[model samples]
Target: MNRRDTILVADDVEINRAVLRSIFEEDYNVLEAENGEQALFLMRQYRDSIAIVLLDLIMPVRDGYEVMEEWQADPSLRGLPVAVITADDSVESEIRVFDLGASDIIGKPFEPHLVRRRIQNIVSLSQRHLDQDDCIREQARKLRESNAAVIDALSSIIEYRSAETGQHIKRIQLFTRVLLEDVAANCPDLGLDESHIAMIVSASSLHDIGKIAIPDAILNKPGRLIAEEFEVMKTHAVKGCEILSRLDRMGDRDYLK
Candidate 1:
């Protein structure tokens, strides 16, 4: 029963607001708005904290439709659960309210228990949705961390096998990051978000990984490679692709592709 799990009751009639507040106040923090404008104001102020809105169709300043329209304009508010309340029991009105994205419509002279149960159901479902989203975000974060670790380990193996300086990989990563930033700024059409940029930077270390298959004598030679030696070096591209193909067969993440 967090104070932030607030239930907003927006109605032009004071008695209805009072009755609704009494029903919800024990389990939730109750907010009363006598007009649509006031309701919208409260909703914006408590957007993150308010769990559900008990909205009235008829109100001064702004109606339920107006408030929902404004709220839905902010993409985050598309999921904000709202229940429309009205004294008019017309089927057309109920259909219109649902079309406006309300969770449910409660006709006036409704049973107190029914109203309470409907609101509790909406709140429970909303909380479950939020919980699921949080879990998914956490799992994605862990997966990214695991992928980075494995990529670094493979890069280190390639660097060691090639007799390359430890600092070589570091410099390549830094250069890749700077170039990615420039591309993001100047070439906006590339549509590269942070995650894509990160993957590219990591994969850059694997560019010369095919060198791992070269002989130690050729790789460690002090002078320029002879024609025969250079030809053998060109095979690194095919070797690297073969390595990646094997890894792909192991069911690696799609980002590796």
Candidate 2:
């Protein structure tokens, strides 16, 4: 019921742990562990408060895979969403983690904003699971409401960072909703539904969210950017994609869908 949720960050490296801690500490209550054993112990001690776990694959005593297996074996902890935050990028490792009951995996050397979005999505999902009933309709309704709130909040943050008016987000949401509806009506085979439309509308507001990372001179320039400035502008799309990609792993495929 708390506005801000709690997150557990488990990593062997002090620098990695500090980096993750710094990302979420301001917005969420963060619990840290140096390795898998400490992570498991903390989970057991504060199981109720912990909403999600950001786990590292390599550790001294009991690795992330081992911790995941242990959690899956325990009835009480089986439902907890474990997101692997590892440097491993191999296809086999990804498959293995999913097979081991990990809910998501994030590759390391990550962007701070991307990490924040991912943690927020997983925390939101975990909270929804706890608060909503088992019925699909109820779950869907709760998800829609939660997603709306999240997208709105994120858009507001983006707007705050830009010189553009807040109406930009509002207009984008309306336009995107209409455009998606038209698409769904014309292409039924695309599997676009109310859920998909809502996601599109919500996510469209973020299409230009990465512009916030751009320098004000380029972002707010009245004229076209030069070759170098245009290249910098292009990074906004990549940044936006990265931010949404991390959230995609948290089970909200709507953004990237």
Candidate 3:
């Protein structure tokens, strides 16, 4: 869909190469090689742009097997799919080509429609992999943005509820984030990234967010809590967990932990 994909056709016969090229040239950028040696050279020269290869088994100098081996050995070329196009339709030929990493096989007297279909399928699959990678990157970006907003909101909630200065929440958040990073580095099993650390620090601010639910008489008391008042104070952790846990906005409980 981006543009007509390029294909390299490797065959010893000039007539076969010409016919194949004529069929594909309308929808593809075509390159031809008379033998395996030329095919490998063209592949290297146009490695980035070429999408697939239509290879023939019998050729002078280097054969198809040797070329396939060379392609598989190179890390850059290893994943490029090759469809073997040869006159040999023997069982041994099919098995050998597949073992050598040919993704597909097309017998000689090449059917134009079948050749077109196989090439399209390989190119489509490659494009799908590219699309999936793009989707993953986009999702990661959105997750980071969501985590940042949650952290800011949690910090605001803490500042609003506490008698301490507004900067108190910000300081505590930074301290918690540093502690989380230290833990993550010292303990690789935690698998914590910067986003996870941010979530944990943000959720830590909400550790006392349930205080908003408590009565002012108990919350703003200047004196130490009596037994009855202490009972009310102990409820904050559970109450905080309940309140934050119910919110669809928060990501996971590890942050609350």
lDDT of 3 by residue, 1-257 (tens): 22327889999999999988998898889999999999999998887678888888888889999999888877657656799988888899888899998878888797888878887888788767666766765675576467667666765765666677267666787889888889988885555777677656756666677776777788778889899998997887788778777764544334445
Error of 3 at 161 (Å): 33
lDDT of 2: 0.80
Regions more than 4 Å wrong, model 2: 1-4, 133-257
Candidate 2 or 3, higher TM-score?
3
Kindly report which residue stretches of model 3 are placed more than 4 angstroms away from their true locations once superposed. 1-4, 134-257
**What TM-score does candidate 1 reach?**
0.61
User: Each prediction's Cα lDDT score?
Assistant: 0.81, 0.80, 0.78
**TM-scores, each model vs. reference:** 0.61, 0.51, 0.53
| Residue pairs in candidate 2 whose N, alpha carbon or C atoms collide under 3 angstroms | none
Between candidates 1 and 3, the one scoring higher on lDDT is: 1
lDDT tens readout by residue for model 2, 120-236: 788788777766534555665666676777677778878877646477878888988888899988875565778668767766787876776788888878897899999998999
- Candidate 3 TM-score, C-alpha based: 0.53
User: Sorted by TM-score, highest first, which candidate order results?
Assistant: 1, 3, 2
Alpha-carbon lDDT of model 1: 0.81
lDDT of 1 at 115: 95
lDDT of 3 at 109: 93
In the predicted model 1, the residue pairs found to clash are none
